[model samples]
Target: MNARTGPLSDVRILDLTQALAGPFCTMLLADLGADVIKVEPPGGDMSRTMGPHPNDRAGTDYGGYFASVNRNKRSVVLDIKTDGGREAIFKLAATADAVVENAKTGVMDRAGIGYDRLRKIKPSLVYAAIRGFGDPRTGRSPYADWPAYDIVAQSMGGLVSITGPAGSDGFRAGPGVGDIYPGTLAALGVVSAIHAARRTGHGQFLDVAMYDAILTLCENIVYTYSRAGVVRGPQGNGTPVLCPFDVFRSRDGAVAIAAPGENHWAILCNAIGRPELIADDRCRNNPKRVANAEFVREAVSAWTTAHTTQEIVAAIGGRVPVGPVNTAKDIFADPHPRARGMLIEVDQPGDNPPLTIAGCPIKFTETPSGIYARAPLLGEHTEQILAEAGITDASKEKS
Candidate 1:
């Protein structure tokens, strides 16, 4: 059976977000059958210009960045500067379950689309605003007006300080957690508010800041600082408190191993043919491993170097929690991704190699999630969405 029945079937969302984070959130809702109408400014979203075209052919307002996160959603272009545009949005918000945007702080307020204004129009409306630091009253006063990206949040939220190694340069995590996480939180918040409205007939004013969300992504550091008065530094590979829990280069690629506790460590030691490690005093427990990490890592790396990634996984995985660090090809070829409906083939007439994105992640026994449509051509659904809002003036409208 096809995975089509979604959870948020009747919900409607006015999407004004762009780039990775905000779009990712709406994509989740859209995949789950939410009526997500992405409202772009007159020229359209900046993501359309971001590269990795469909088939290296004529650009059709498509970007790999845009395609990956935005699917099963309609598109609408509106110049909110015009009175007709503002009225169109007001009309949409009146009936919509939620409105989402990722503008710099106060931009929405200046444009007359802030939560305060929208809530007045629709009392039970949920306004989801994704900002860089936070809203004006939420401690991002200084940077509220300043522009930000994923790296900015990574640096300010303490992730850059703790990434990499002792001597390596500070770095951001591979993914844009700064934007994505906040957007995710905002989406979750919007749905929660919608649920509340369903029961109480009152919506919420929600704002998720990239800095705030990314900060939550690395919460252990905060507690560690508060309790022990010890600040964490650049740490590469394994977790600070665990042993044999890092990536190692195999003959071909790499593999990740995790020996979180003493039991797992003992099992790994046996697998590596170093049974004496269990009795070693300096390497006996977790605290000891944290103190003498370099020595233990060196010993483990040396042992792992002799085996293939798969061999190492077979030898220590499950028993000692080892796993192979796979690449894109590995993921595409893996049997599990196919079986679990995590990977799907999309028909693209304009593609040379064809477009295939990671499928919807939600899995329900009765209602499953799957891709319904590709990113729309610029303003493809402008009229369609406006019609849904019952707007008669198609030539002059904002969606």
Candidate 2:
């Protein structure tokens, strides 16, 4: 099953990205059956060195971080700083439907292979970039030149401002949402631009800034501040507007329970043996419950703490919006992921055992998408990819 098999099988993409944001965007395309050719420098993507490596596999070229996102793509080595390398990129772009990168503002332009140059070779190419701030062509920022990572974007974009415990400095999320959200948006932008280019016979440049994407994710802050002059603070686990919409303690672990609607609230009240609270004046409705949030929380917590996480889930899992806070261990033991195909196993390089990674979530009735190949060894497909692109001579230098 080496042949591509999804809706994007007809499309080809040149991936000149590294690390999370850029690679993640291209990964989505590859999973959807786009023939993504990853153009790597001689040393390969920096993430190849990042670990959670196989415990027994020594001298492995790549680790879980690289494997997780680079699946279903071919890799080619190129030293874009050289004439031969630049020529190879041009040749590849000429046959590609799109080019995606996550370099800083002027990095690609200085190398002489930026979107401006690539678009000339393939006028219908969708050129997309992911940056810490934004590309100057779209809108220049004062901090455009400054380098940023996940934490920086999360802080500057207002996500960290309204997260974590109330009355204290905000907490960074467990995952790199700053990069992931921006990457997800870039994937959407790429698909949209490709659709437009196919229709209009002209491609355009699109960019997703990490800071901007994070801001969009925290959109509620913008409207709340603008409409009511209210600077929302850290909300902790629960929102200020909704009562009984939080993670409560259980004997074994924690479970998230939300019953903000009238009917759900009544159902929850009966389930927790607090039926009289449904008619109580201070906690009768959603608004009143919000006003007396402490009382409501104590009431829910009192019942939840006495039972196990699974017990609470069993009581109201389907009737109300409730679920336990699941860790990786719990997820591995659960049957839902297995039924949904949300976990997949693929072999690794060297003598390592097969590794499991999260699977693609998008589902299609006819054209299903999934991981079909493991991540390539550094420049694994260089000769084949170059030949496919009709490039007879190209530099394979590490620089």
lDDT of 1 by residue, 49-112 (tens): 8867766556456767777787788888888887788888888889799999888877888899
Worst 10 residues of 1 by lDDT: 345-354
lDDT of 2 by residue, 20-87 (tens): 99999999999899999999998899999898888654645888999999999999989997888998
lDDT scores for all predictions?
A: 0.81, 0.91
| Number of the top lDDT candidate | 2
Query: What is the C-alpha local distance difference test score of candidate 1?
Result: 0.81
Once fitted onto the true fold, the runs of candidate 2 whose alpha carbons sit more than 4 angstroms away are 56-59, 393-399
Tell me which residue pairs clash in candidate 1. Answer: none
CA RMSD of each candidate after superposition: 2.3, 1.5
